[model samples]
Target chain A: MPSGALLFQSVLLGILLGGLYALLASGLTLYFGIMRVVMIAHSAFLILAAYLGWWLHERAGLDPLLAMLGTVPLFFGAGVLLQRVLLTRLRPATLTMMSVLLTFAIALLIEGLLGYAFTGTQRRVQLGYGSASLEVFGARVAVVKLIAFGLAVVALGTLYVLMKRTRFGWALRATIQHRDAARLLGIDTDRVAGYGFGIGLATAAIGGTALSLDTTIYPSLHWHWIGPLMAIIVVGGLGSVPGAAIAAMVLGMAQSLLQIPMGTTWAQTVFYVALFATLAIRPQGFFGGRLAQRF
Target chain B: MPSGSKVLKLAAVALLAVAVLAFPSIAPNPYILSAGVLVVYYAVLATSWNFVGGFTGYISLGHGALAGLGAYSTGILVAKAGLPPFLALAAAGAFVGLLAVPIGLAALRVRGASFVIVSISLVLILLLVFQSWSSVTGGSRGLVVPRPFQLTRPEHHRIFYFLFAGLLALAVLAWWLIDRSRFGLGLKSIREDEDKAEALGTATYAYKLIVFVVSAVFTALAGGLYALWFGDLDPVFQFSILTGSYLVLMALLGGVRQLFGPVVGALIVGIALEFFKVEYGDTPLHLVATGLLLALVVLFMPDGVLPAIADLIKRFGRSDRTSIREVSAAELREQRLQNAGGTK
Candidate 1:
């Protein structure tokens, strides 16, 4: 119904949205990959980080993008402490069920604290170029979206290299693939899990900073994001970062394309629907057979 | 298993039922009656949730959506079709029950954490659908249900209080019947080991579907009743994940293995939550308190407070006779651990 230019523009916009989604989902996959914990509180952490960005921007006059430089490591340390203090004590036998309850409690705690501090009112980062758009091949792209996409690409690329090229990343991957075997090879898995969880939270900081740049956020807004991020990870295959990234892009494009045909609310159903369809058809996901399910 | 103890237990239950029935008559206060009504509503929701989540060992986070479906179904039928309120309520429950068939089939294929994800996604999808379908659902403006009975506010609250209390009793009765039946044993087997159950000739899928539908139907009934009693239907409150998780929290906190676990859970949580909201006003303190309660319960009383208390009571009393019949819940945990498979 729309022109070729319109469809192209929607696809581009969708890709940008997917990139943002991928940033959030990659952290979830990393946690699940290494810790075998669902980390349902992930969106809550992302929201908290976004609030941090908002606070930094308001008080220190730092850009949200720049705020991540300080907050990411801070969050990483928090995650490590969290793992060491609480999650590490859970029995491996009941981790799958217990973690859901534990993380749910953690999520409620974070949401309540954030609500207590910031109230439920929505807040957004007022950055330069927020309302400006650049024309590219007849499609107008918001500069904020472009920057978010660029940040997502850079973060994801760093994650890819860290997993593939570094010793710690290799240790992390080895632990994920076969924990007992890796332990036999002297991988100090407890330390890896602690750091792995920290890495996941660090990614949340990145995603949160990007989110503040583009959208209005409140303590409760995490509820709206959890479903879509989970869907992306599920569609990508539970622990595969590259698979999740591709799935996020595909979901983003589908949502954008659907928006052309229907309303935006209806378009948002794309990922959840994809999630159900994926579970029904291929529960192992697009990256099935690549890795054994760790739990 | 002693005859005298059985008779004593029956007497205790009978006395409790009589007291509950006489509560409205004795109190005669609108505030107390409303709180009673809220507690009964939660009892019905949490007990119904236990059918799937407890007996069947599927941690469903989408039961709230079932209730929402029921509320909207009743609302639409009464508001748009001009159906009678009571008839619409029954129809709404059945409608939601039928709706769960395909969804349960799709979601129950996956196990453990994936199932939780699917369950949450279903509720979110339903919430979005109800919110966006403004033409039928009235969207964010909300829908009002026509009350069938004409009575004063206090009298209306009293009547609904009785109605919800009766529903809770019925739900408990159904839970008891299911617990004693072959069909329930089939479900417990599925909860224990689906593959083993199937190998041993249990139709695991059918049993799961039946229990899931039954759970959804009762949840829908509570929703429809809530819509009627409250006279307002908003998708956000009706289909909220927070409400869904609260259902899990109550059921888990009360001891899902016990038939009346949800009732005790509902009573404690419902009353505490009400008082907290009243005391704390609009701040996030109530949520913080709820989180603390859930954490404390999960950490200290993993088998639920009822079982833990029963254990303490037995220890203090030093009775050789078993006070409560223990279900094979340990097997359920074993099944989940097996599903978790390799260490991570």
Candidate 2:
């Protein structure tokens, strides 16, 4: 009973949102896939990037997109250092509990510092193009979304090429598949892990920039992003980047559609129900082949 | 000698109970009394959480949702159904325990990190449900239930504090009983290695379910008490991850594996945070402190403050045994060999 134009608009909006979701989830899935680290700190890193973008935009009048060139490297280095110093020591331990506590602590620290500096008030990156829109099939779509989607596609495409074609990428994949075998073959497993973490964190920059374009940023955004990120990772099949992309789209579409039928508060519940149901049926997830390879 | 140990334990329990019973009267200040009540509440929640999270190694991130279920259920019974307070509390606990069964079945199929993911997802789902179902759950504004007993006098307030203290004491006793019971041993075995436990003919699933349901019951009871104390029930207060963090922090700071660890940890952390709040007003310093403390505790003292203190006590007690027999390297190697053989 929905209008065709409205339905088309919904689909387009969903795709745009999904692109951003995929950008956020890629880092999470990559870290999990390559290093077997859940990286609960991922959302915190994204928030950190968002804050950095906000700071640059406010102070230097720099575009949030331009700020990524600097923040990406900084977060990448931080991620690598974190893995080398803290996570490396906890290897072969259950790591799950410790990781949760560790990442939660980091998140708390970030949120606290942000609150102290910026207060709890929400801020948005006010780009000149933020309010610009394009009319399509009797619906107006924001130009920022289009730009964000374009950037996401470009970034993901480049990442795909790097992951599938590069020598380091092969090593990363090999290590994920069989650590013992990879080590036996003289691959620098530690280096791969470090770089994988770095790359994972760099993706956060892309996601944060995209996010700031659309929504309001606050100290609590880390908490808000974590639930959706976790959902996407689980539904996509942990450790599968392409699977994450597909799942994010599906979830984004589902969420957008649910918003039209059920109110905003209920939209989150629908996604979680779908997540639970999916977990019950396919705990390995939709693209679980990669997961099985590791297990 | 074993009888002496048992007597000592019983004496400790009696003394602790007496001290708790006398605390409200001893500390007449409303702030201190309220803090004491809060400590007991967290202690109960933390101990209940320990049964499944520590003993079974399930790490349920959604326990606050379970507690919320209990609070909301009790509130509805009292306000909508006109049930008596005590009866509503009992019903709430039972209902929440029952609700945990299906979630347990679905979640426990996965091991390790996957379990944590599922638990957290469950929490988010429940929070959304509570927020969205305005007619039933009273929406974001939430329903305010009347106090279980009117606090017309300071004596009445003292009585409620004592009541909560008693409930906390009961929860502690229940946890201690479970800790020493055969079921506890089964749980420990499963935690050490589930495949090994299953190989040894332990019904891992059944024991997990039992521990989870029992934990849920205790958590729900605490929730009921919370509603009674605050005279209000709201989704944000009940189902927040902040509540979940309270349990995690208490368990971690107290010593996850120890019986009285959560009790000590909850009291210490709760008091410390209270002091911070009083000192700093609404500054974010407390969050920073909490984060730093959490990191330090996990990194440096995984056994928690209680266990660390226990170790110190044991070391001091053993310091006089100068002629204690020490294992030779050969003997230790032989022991390792035997262990390996036994495992094989």
DockQ of each: 0.57, 0.47
**Model 2, A1-295: lDDT tens per residue?**
6887877888899899888889889988877776566766788778878888999999999998999899888988998887778776652444666777777777788888988999989999988888999998798899988988987888899888888999988998898888889999999999888888888888888778777777898886686677888888877878888888999999988887777777677776655776677667877778767462321
On DockQ, the leading prediction is 1
lDDT digits (tens) for residues B201-319 of candidate 2: 99987898888889999999988878877677888778877678768888989987777788878888888878987999988777788888887876778668876876688787755
Chain A alone, TM-score per model: 0.96, 0.95
Give me the runs in candidate 2 sitting further than 4 Å from their true place: A290-295, B3-10, B319-344
Best by lDDT: 1
lDDT of 1 by residue, B38-135 (tens): 88899999999999888767777778888888988998999999999999999998888888888777676656667788888888898899889899
Candidate 2 structure, TM-score to reference: 0.93
Error of 2 at B220 (Å): 0.8
- TM-scores of all candidate predictions against the true structure: 0.93, 0.93
Q: Please report how far candidate 2 places residue B184 from its true position, in Å.
A: 1.7
Q: Which residue pairs show backbone clashes in model 1?
A: none
The prediction achieving the highest TM-score against the true structure is 1
Cα displacement (angstroms), candidate 1, residue B90, comes to 1.6
